[model samples]
Target: MRPKIYLYGDSITEESFGDGGWGASLSHHFSRTVDVVLRGYSGYNTRWALKVAERIFPPVESGGVPPLAVTVFFGANDACLPDRYSAFQNVPLHEYKQNLHSIISFFKKRWPEIVILLITPPPIDEDARLRHPYIENPSGLPERTNEAAGAYAQACISVAKECGCPVVDLWIKMQECPDWKQAYLSDGLHLTQAGNRIVFEEVVKKLKEQGISVENLPVDLPLIANIDPQDPLKAFQDY
Candidate 1:
């Protein structure tokens, strides 16, 4: 069976298979080599994800092949400012940190061989948020802010360090770009094509750093040109 890579998180991840999305890019890049599984639940926080993680990703010890890699991307919803947004979705900073640590620890203890990557929440664009029809506030403010998201991102970074896991620091990296508000994020909270590209490239870079070579991955099947028309079975058997 082909190796699997799981992308687990919230809305950003749920839409990651859409046009110009990072998940789609990864799928294309790893074609015939690995299965990129999307385990995204839109609008979910770490608290919600932790409750369902076991059901979604069974312990590797239970059987079958464990995923080659798994990315834990949360914090976006958890970073929601309680005073502005629904309290149901808001997770305290301390709890957010704890949840991330628990999630990473669970995976590490369950699947020691699997590579884990923790992704920091990307920065939010207040201007874009205010312009969004559904996100308009009476005070002309956004429910989330870059500053708030940055705090969660730092928490994620801290968790990564504590767990000895690699991380994709999206919050910091996105801001480094020129006019990142327009260039990276589409709706202040979500990623655009360029943003997805950045994510895909970063993921590839991380995998390389972990000694996982995409170029060296074996294709799912033998090349058609290598098949013998007169002896199809021979080619199949050889492969």
Candidate 2:
């Protein structure tokens, strides 16, 4: 039985233009491996993602919905500081942390054996911060700077550790390849096709390096735990 994988996150994950976004590109790696379900939503945060996770992986609905592994990506929308991005603002760090903890706890409670991976949002445009003026309005006072983006990424790692969740550190990867602006990102935050491909490639490389092929695997496999955080040979983050 092919494993069912579900992705839950923001607009980037929702763009299923077949390999258009990172999640779409990641889907291809599983084309010959397992069944992939895309559940990316636009303008979403941890609170809503928790709801989506509940709907997708309802508790005790055996034989009703097939077993599926889940991966979550947030922070992009959460960074909208001061709760002031046009109609939204940055999610308070405390609130954001609590919301994330809720999502992880709920999933762990529902499916203790399921794989729940967390991915931090990619970098925001530094020199181009002023480009997205939609963030501030006449009444909106600036709350945070773009440099603070990485701080949230760091917080994400901490949250993963707290939940014992597997993490895919896209922030560091983008830093290593700083020219991602020309290579992968079009809107600074969201990834371009090439960028998505880069993310997918790394995901596949990590999965294969762990000896668990997504191809034709059972849902019972702990795809999350199968990945060792203490292992140095495979991931730079782990090392």
Specify the highest-TM-score model's number. 1
CA deviation > 4 Å runs, candidate 1: 60-63, 133-136, 225-233
Q: What are the per-residue Cα lDDT tens digits for candidate 1 across 1-239? A: 78889999998999999999999998999888899999999989999999999899976554567789998999989988898844568899999999998888778877888999889999999888878724437766678888999999999999899888999999999999978999998888899999999899999899879976667778788767877888878867745
Candidate 2 lDDT at 229 equals: 70
| Superposition-based RMSD of candidate 2 using all C-alpha atoms, in angstroms | 10.6
Lowest-scoring 10 consecutive residues by lDDT in candidate 2? 137-146
Q: Write the per-residue lDDT of candidate 2 for residues 36-61, one digit (tens) a residue.
A: 77778887877667666667665544
TM-score for all predictions? Answer: 0.92, 0.76
Global lDDT of each model?
0.88, 0.66
Error of 2 at 69 (Å): 2.4
What are the C-alpha RMSDs, in order, of all predicted structures? 2.0, 10.6
